[model samples]
Target: MFGLKDLIGLIISCFIILPVVTFIRETGYFIISGLLGAKNPRLTIGSGPRFFKFKFIDIRRYYHVYSWFSFDFIKAKSKFAYISIYAGPILINAAVALVINALLANDFFEDSKTFWNRFIFYVFYFVLFDAIPMKTVNGKPNNGMIIYELLRYGKRIDYNEDPIIPGTTEAEEEYQKEVEKMKEIKWKEVEEEETFYTDKKG
Candidate 1:
């Protein structure tokens, strides 16, 4: 039966645990790609308008909903390099889950065992989805699919012109443009509302 405890757990999972796991997953990309000499890398968290940015990390308003890592270019552009980059998130999450599981088995963090268990669960959940070779709902291939294609054909099979990792500069420019458009729309709405009130008053 659903109760207050379940509700609290759900809130923690959605807000805190999930966001941390997501940040870790995206960090896998940053770490692997950085090692391979990726230039101008940026890790963007969430979607919609920007909230704030710190160094390489960009936090959006609706944080915890979505996140991605982007780089302008990679020095080592080989099939093997691409495979490693794609496999990064899967391996990283799996490693974290295993470590947590082991710690739990040894009776570590007994006081917050439930929290740690939930954390491990979400970590493995991320690993499972990332390690599976399939296209997402938007038709874009996931990391597993990309790795599989590279292993089998030694090349990306998808004819999509867009690169797997977008350029940091390009992404920022596009985001700024989106913000401007949003501001313009809001201004228009405010003007219309004011005009409507004036007419009604007169």
Candidate 2:
């Protein structure tokens, strides 16, 4: 038999808790990547086909709770891409945990490990789980594994062939923009290197 608190917790977890936490994580990725100059970085929430979708700035939010973050391969420099991808779950989880702790200290939540407490703990668990490299059930790499691979080999584990959201042509446009941005970045680097060499010579 579920008590009032339990029932309320269940409802909030289903409708609010999961969705809000997931949004914060995904949006963190989007914001960090964009600030790092990623071009058309596509941020997604949930795994399945999108039921509700919209674009904000350079982000596309898929309205569901179960979520992950991804970006165009060519969108960012390798280091920036790695940080942006890795920052989502880790940064948000830490920030949320701190806030939750403060709230609990203020008696916002009960001292016992209730639903709210457990929710906060679960968020922290997710951060650790993702930050530790491991493979998923289907043998695909998790975020930590991807970050490790990227740092070591300059490549990431290719989890899927089609990295596109269903029923959307955004990937195509994003790819084109990614290519153009990469080209620009490449030329800029080359020009900067030449200038540096010229200045050294003179």
Candidate 3:
């Protein structure tokens, strides 16, 4: 059995990923060169099954199709009409899991809505996942860019947290090198952060 900490971490990550899955399922489209002439196009599913699938069309192309579909599933070319289709599942699925956990514990999160819960979950999820890169911009895993972009674009990174661009800043470069060192040494979070800040701050 996993410990409470592990369970909590899982839920947080799930919430973030679930919405992205939903967004992709709904709005995003993939094209496959392997679409067999024999198979029924009528029965398309996730990752579209084809004898040989090819790269999905660009996000822009999918965007056009989704727009016409009226924000539904990929039912119409224009259905599932949003770019953040994957985002829905990432958010909702995690929420559902957390909700179930809360209900079993007789904690409703006050009708499944609490700002503090949301914030903490986001923080946990961001810390874990921001370490791991997400694939955007043509399914390319943008590694260090994740945390950088969140800080840069979303302004989630605190002013107190160093504002170094991931690769450009010497401090950030050192930070990343330290992260790699921890990974190499398999240092746990407490040890990693402690050492990282100690060296960087000192």
Top candidate on TM-score is 1
Instruction: At residue 183, give the lDDT of candidate 3.
Output: 76
Worst 10 residues of 1 by lDDT: 156-165
RMSD of each: 1.3, 18.1, 18.1
lDDT of 3 by residue, 38-129 (tens): 11112122231123323322122121112100111233321122112223323443554455456646755566444345544553453344
Best by lDDT: 1
Question: What ranking of all candidate models by TM-score puts the best one first?
Answer: 1, 2, 3
Error of 2 at 132 (Å): 1.9
The list of candidate 2 runs beyond 4 A from truth reads: 1-5, 43-54, 57-64, 68-75, 106-115, 157-202
Task: Return the TM-score for each candidate structure.
Answer: 0.95, 0.61, 0.22
Per-candidate count of clashing residue pairs (backbone under 3 Å)? 0, 0, 24
Q: lDDT per residue, candidate 2, 71-152, as tens digits? A: 5444456665665557566787778888987888788867554766867866777788778888775676666777787788
- Regions more than 4 Å wrong, model 1: none
Candidate 3 global lDDT = 0.37
Span of 10 residues, lowest total lDDT, candidate 2: 160-169
